[model samples]
Target: MKKVLSMMMVLLLFVGMLAGCTSNTAPTETKEPEALKMGLVVSTLNNPFFVTLKDGAEAKAKEIGAELIVLDSQNDPAKELANVEDLVTKKVAAILINPTDSDAVGSAIKLANEAKIPVITLDRGANAGEVVTHIASDNVAGGKMAGKFIVDKLGGSGKAVELEGIAGTSAARDRGQGFNEAVNGTGIEVVAKQTADFDRTKGLSVMENILQAQPEINAVFAHNDEMALGALKAIEASGREIMVVGFDATDDAVKAVEEGKLAATVAQQPDKIGSLGVEMADKVLKGESVDSFVPVDLKLVTK
Candidate 1:
């Protein structure tokens, strides 16, 4: 009888121990909150300005512990569409886009809107769809600065060439408009206005052609630095002394300015634009509202 009682007590103790072990959980087993997933669609990683923009966005994402998925459109509208659709499939919390073309990006923005994902514009804006905010510099103002510099330098009389960006891009349109407005009343005559598609190679070829056709060109204003540098090379090859003004004060462009090779370049804060876009997306994800248009500052860099 003593032995049986001892066995029963041991069984009861074992049962209690089992219950305690099953009910108690380790304090270290606490769950972590999921990271917010965001998407960034760049028009092209080819340009240094856009590359810096991407780096800024990535830095912000790392600082805030958010997941950022970056995609390159390669400056193709079709590729941009494909990129947006892929992001939508992933069901990201928000999408920030630097559109290849303002008009072409409308359909891509519509996809995100249909999926109930928040959309924000980084450097460029979309004309077709709804967006929570547009973060960029005042492109028109920058263009005006470039134009006025040329006018003032030439004492209101000079022959210049305008190298345009992608035709349908907002940056191109606004920059062209502002430049034209600035030169309207002045004696600065834009002898040649051509599209180089914002590419250095195209700029080189176009400028080479123009140099052959036009004998007397005083200045050249390119929408972006890549084209400006390209035109500069062509002019150098032909040994012509012409003032070249570029936009997007990229590192190379700034260097050119410092070396007295480039007259001046309108500087836009691309990194700030990128960082601001991510910050705005974060706000929207947290149920906060943002402005319809968020404009970054711009300045002119010259030697």
Candidate 2:
């Protein structure tokens, strides 16, 4: 009977030992918070317009010691896609993109979403996609502002040639839309409208062609400063009685306005847009809600 009691105690102790071993082997699941890694895919760093944006984003990212990876798209949708793909491979926590084309960028945005990375669009936006936030100016309003400036400069009646920016860009489309609405039913007629690809050389060539076709062109509405400058060259070469209007209030364009060469420009604060975009991204990453459309203020520069 004593031996039986000993065996029972031994079995109980073994069971207890097994239970302790099992308890020790069980893992305590712990989840670690991820570090913030940010990426920016810009249209082009070649232009001073996007350069200011880059500077603003970089400064803000460095302020908080967050990792920032910036890539230049050169206004190519294919390149933009490749850049975003590379960033995804790196497993960035968030992405900031200024899409080259609204529709073309949807797939890239979807890929990022599939990877569980939040994307914030800056300056320009994607068409219909899952984006955390879109920060930009009221481009339509800006276009209207430019149109009003043209009318005021011409005293409400003149023949104008619209030097459009690159195709498939929000800036080009909305600005053109607003300008058309402002001039709707007005005596000031748009004699010709053509794309200048937002480049000075292209603007010059396209303006020259338009001038040949419409020699009585009274004004040229260039979508950006570079194109405006190009249009100025064509006007000088053609010896046409013409005034030039431009957008994006770039330094050179502002100087032109100050010099009485170009009439006016709608100033867009790209730097401010970049800074604000970063702030919004940060807020969203912290599990906070942000505004869907963050509109940056635009100013008209005539002097």
Candidate 3:
């Protein structure tokens, strides 16, 4: 009877050891991921095109398990510089910027460079700085496309008016250069060239004044969709049929083309520019080498 009791006690001890082992070997709960942060500074959120670009960057950040902090410059170069300084203060791992003015943004970019933060430019480029990459559509090529479209629509000869963007921006300069190059010997006379600052109200007002002066204008090319839509408003009010072409195919501009309101627009992939900027920032943060000039695709959109 004693021997039987001893064997039962040993069995109970074995059961206790097994229970302790199981408790120690249980699975652990998963921990949450670390939040990595990046910065994006855009020229303006007032335009739908830039809004779409911001949305694309946010989506890409979420996909890559990172957080994006965005700042709007409101199309002010001084404000853009302030925004970059603020981003540097936040100690962001990287920065992506769309400059309001290419040359004026140099100081802001210089600040980022001094901070050792990787910089990537989207849509517009800085005239001076050491940026890791510049991701944008070939604005020069897109401009040539717009010019060619206008020339073709006008049968290679017509009086045209050019509504320009902010004077010192790369977008404005490159687009103007391309357009001028394409129409040099095509018999398309640029009757008037004026800077509307890429604003709808300014574009409308400027075009209205131009219409009063040049009633024989047959084609209008604005540097951006906002200006194009504004020019359309003026053209409609004048009760004249003018072939209007623009750059940056925003959603409204594309719809306008489909409805035959505006003749055509050179479509730059703004969303792709934003997303690729983020991707390149990630690469730079990871010490990966990326192409200096990452060209996004451009296409001519016509009704």
Report lDDT (CA) for all predictions. Answer: 0.94, 0.87, 0.93
Q: Residue 217: error of model 1 in Å? A: 1.3
Q: For residues 129-201, could you state the per-residue lDDT of candidate 1 as single tens digits?
A: 9999999888899889999999999999989999999999999998998888889988888889999999999
TM-score of each: 0.94, 0.87, 0.90
Collision pairs in model 2: none
Clashes of each: 0, 0, 0
TM-score of 3: 0.90
Model 3 alpha-carbon miss at residue 208, Å:
0.4
lDDT (Cα, 0-100) at 202 in candidate 2: 93
- Evaluate residue 102 in candidate 3 and report its C-alpha lDDT on the 0 to 100 scale: 94
Ordered by lDDT, highest first, the candidates read 1, 3, 2
The ten-residue window of minimal lDDT in model 2 covers 31-40
lDDT of 2 by residue, 1-303 (tens): 999999999999999999999999999999976557899999888677888888888888877767789999998989999999999999988899998888888988998999999999998788857998899989899989888888887889999889887787888898899989988878799999999888889999998888878858777788888899999988888776688888888888899899988888889988888887788888988899998899999999887
Best by TM-score: 1
TM-score for candidate 1 = 0.94
